[model samples]
Target: MDPGGEVSVSEAPSQVPPTAMGGEEEEPGEQEEEEPTAPKKSRLEEESLRAPMDAAEHYVELRAENLKDQEPEEPEDENLKDQEPEEPEDENLKDQEPEEPEDENLKDQESEEPEDENLKDQEPEEPEDQNLKDQEPEEPEDQNLKDQEPEEPEGPEDGGPQREALDFSHTPQMLTGSWAEFSSLPENYLKGCKWAPDGSCLLTSSADNVLRVYDLPSELYAPCWQLLPEMSPVLRMAEGDTIYDYCWYPHMSSLDPNTCFLASTSRDNPVHVWDAFDGKVRGSFRPYNHLDELTAAHSLCFSPDGSHLYCGFDKMVRVFHTERPGRDCEERPTIVKKRGVTGIVSCVSFSSSRALYACGSYSCGVALYSCQDGAPVAVLPTRHQGGLTHLVFSPDGTYLYTGARKDPEILCWDLRAPDKVLFSLQRNVGTNQRIYYDLDPSGRYLLSGDTSGLVSVWDTTHCASYRSSEELQPPHLTFQAHWDCTNGLSVHPFLPLLASSSGQRQFSWPSDSEDSGSDTDLGAPQERRQENCVCVWWSGPPGASAPGPEDTEDREPAEQEVPVCV
Candidate 1:
């Protein structure tokens, strides 16, 4: 019990008296004892009970004060609650209201049809003398006239539409008796031949140390090409030097005879730049080492612009300035080598853009050099077991075509990805001789001469499709081009014509050398047989009377029977 008559519930026993909450009266004995203790308790007990009661009262008052402090504030202006809310302005309605005036104005304009009627009723005014001027004849001064009358349209042969596709169904008519009769001289086998850029002349190089430039007939459709007595060689070589390689300047033209200059490399001598019209040497450039040992150039090529001349030696390439060929070339050449292969540079070629040049060696791979620095940019290792004999770049310079000696496949390499070959074309390569080939002016077809005296034409588009398929198709067309091996091939620059030469190389048998004294017959020199002839082919569409049966009369013989060195 608390002193103030308040109960201390925490101090109470588990079971309280029945009268604790004033629900019922307590027993007399219990009530008497509780009343006495409550009034006469010790001072300490009174103080303890009084403490709890005071604390309870203080807590209740504090809670009431907090509740009063939590009430929200009220506005001081009392009239604000009585005002009516204003509605927001309707933007769409405002827009619609302003457009009503514009719509009215448009209606007013539409209703005014009288203005248009007035425009229609007004009479059209005429110029003063427009009809008279139109009706009058156009005099010579008033006419829209040209200084000279336009010439009549020329025929196809003159300036007409060009023929698109050439007929390959029939053999081309052979231009005979031009070089065939001339090559009949002893030891006068044709080595190299090229047609002029303007298709007006043909140049041939012979092993007999001669260069013959023949003037071709203007019309190729003549029944026969008659050899005129005046048609002699415009250029010829002096005694003792034999032409190994020759190339015409890329800008050569028949119209400007002064530009008809050719660069030829001869045995044991410097390269000579000859004037084709006058048979005179324009200039000569010799390549010599520090020891003064003369190096003979086996292959030569002029750059596309005729600014530089590249000559391939055994182990290096010598570059000469064509504009000033009288000066000697640098003593040190651009040498390139490969692992496990001795460098014997055999062939060289220049890209169409002249930004880069490529050189092929006997056992080494092909080396590509930049024209700016003359430094090697890339090396495409030989893919076949044989040596590269010939190389040519595509017209756009994106791909390179390489032919290897004794290798029956012609490899097309993508310059962007040169590590692997893009395509391999099959051809008959039974001989060890360097088989010359050329690409058409359009770069669409590749024509190559084979050891079987056949010329094969391949579609470059079809060959490039090998990247997508596994099986490769054969050449587009094939025809017998010669009776013996076709050693030289060239394509006309402006016409659908092909020029080829037939010549077989003779090799002495081993038994003939070893048993020279065993038999008197063996001592006798064997008569060397050479086809020694050149043929011009017309690739235009054949006429109704064209020869057919005779085309297949000289079919290619079996490969084993061909007299090719092993």
Candidate 2:
């Protein structure tokens, strides 16, 4: 009953007044008579009467416990609870009501709304992360696309000078002939032929100490040409003595007049750079000897860039600045400090892809040097049987092919393993004359001429598995190219065409009168056949026909082909 008491709800029964539980009887005699023992109330009626009272007591006890645990409640709040006895019963009924749960649902929605918003915000980022993952693989593809960009420009830059693909699956045909063109003199013979870099014209050297330029027939690209006409020289350069060596400017182009010139060396003349158009001497590079006397170069070649001209001489090599001609030159001794390539430097060649150049000596020696300072790189052992005359590097700069005068074999040297020869190509070169050989632009085919009037073609893709000291590798194709000895061979820069020259010294002999055959012409002295001329052959597939003039004027039968397939 006291608000300050420490009594708990479980112990309240023991302390309650007896009247509340009917534990004490009101005067026994008066109670029995006056009330006649009011019928005992039913359990339901008693529970109904006690429920509100019990709820109020429980609420008061809870409030007392809360006040003790925290700050004390205000007196006004306690007075309000005591004044409204039925308020606690009403609160309990309200908690049990369905409408109160609806109020609770409103509270729950208030708490969960931001959570839903947070989940929505996260949903978009999930797709963004996925998008980033998708783009990861594309980065490399983008890089690859960028990498291929430069190669496209390089294709056009390099492709401008690239050689045209050739198909040699057909019988070779003669494009033109120059027999009558060179027949003006009795002993005149072609020495060599070279195609201009632009494929616009050709150049030829002859025993007459003359260099001739022949322009490609303009109308040859027409539909047909009934007769192969004799080719005439567009320009002729006469030298005082024998022409030792001559080469076109590596970057020679007809369209650029400044670059249209060639270099030549003669027996007693200085190196002359002649105009390709007018045959005028553009300049001269004069190399001097230790005696300070003017000397002629045995072989001459322009550097790959055409910035300098390299000349081969006996025991020395000279470099002349192309722009600065005359006596000014850089002398590089092949035999340096007592050791190096020996004999006359007969030939010089440069590698297009590397900083190296090769030199051949007449003493059967070959050497490599740095292009920068002419530093000695390597000197290959002497394997050639005669004086070295020509040296050429494979297009890839990984191999070197060497030929010697009077040597039967053109040796292929693998620069990667320079200690040994990769293979040997056999050709009949009995005389002490330079027998030139050429490789296709792709470096897949090797071609050369022999003294027996035959042209030979070798497939370089195949390598021999075994070796014998005296064995010579056979060519893929061999054919009698001329009636006289076929001595010069050159491949066109871009076309599927080959130019060859044939000639040799012939000795006249008197035939025995009694043993002379009936077919012999008695009026003429018995001499070797002299076919001293330039000829062009079409080396293409059988299906693709060559362009010729439509009219069949002055037509002649095709030469009898004697192709030997091996």
Best by TM-score: 2
Off by over 4 Å in 1: 1-165, 177-187, 221-234, 330-342, 468-473, 508-530, 543-566
Against the true structure, whose lDDT is highest? Answer: 2
**C-alpha lDDT (0 to 100) for residue 277 of candidate 2:** 94
Q: Per-residue alpha-carbon lDDT of model 2 for 1-566, expressed as tens digits?
A: 87546557656665443445775544333433543465764454355445546877899999988887684344444555687665755544455688866765665466466556766877778888888887777887786556443212132234333343455554456677677667777577778888887777889998899999998776555444444566888899998899999999988878789999999999988999999999999989888888889999999989999999999999889999999988899988887665669888999999989999999988888999888888788888767889888888888999898999888898887888777788888888888767788888888788999877789888777644444324678888887777666878988766667899877665555545667655454433133456788888777543324634332222232233221111
* Deviation (Å) of 532 in candidate 1: 1.7
Clashing pairs counted in every model: 0, 5
Kindly report which residue stretches of model 2 are placed more than 4 angstroms away from their true locations once superposed.
Answer: 1-164, 223-227, 464-470, 509-527, 547-566
RMSD of 1: 23.3
lDDT of the structure predicted as candidate 1: 0.65
Candidate 2 has its poorest 10 consecutive residues by lDDT at 557-566
**Candidate 2 at 402: error in angstroms?**
0.6
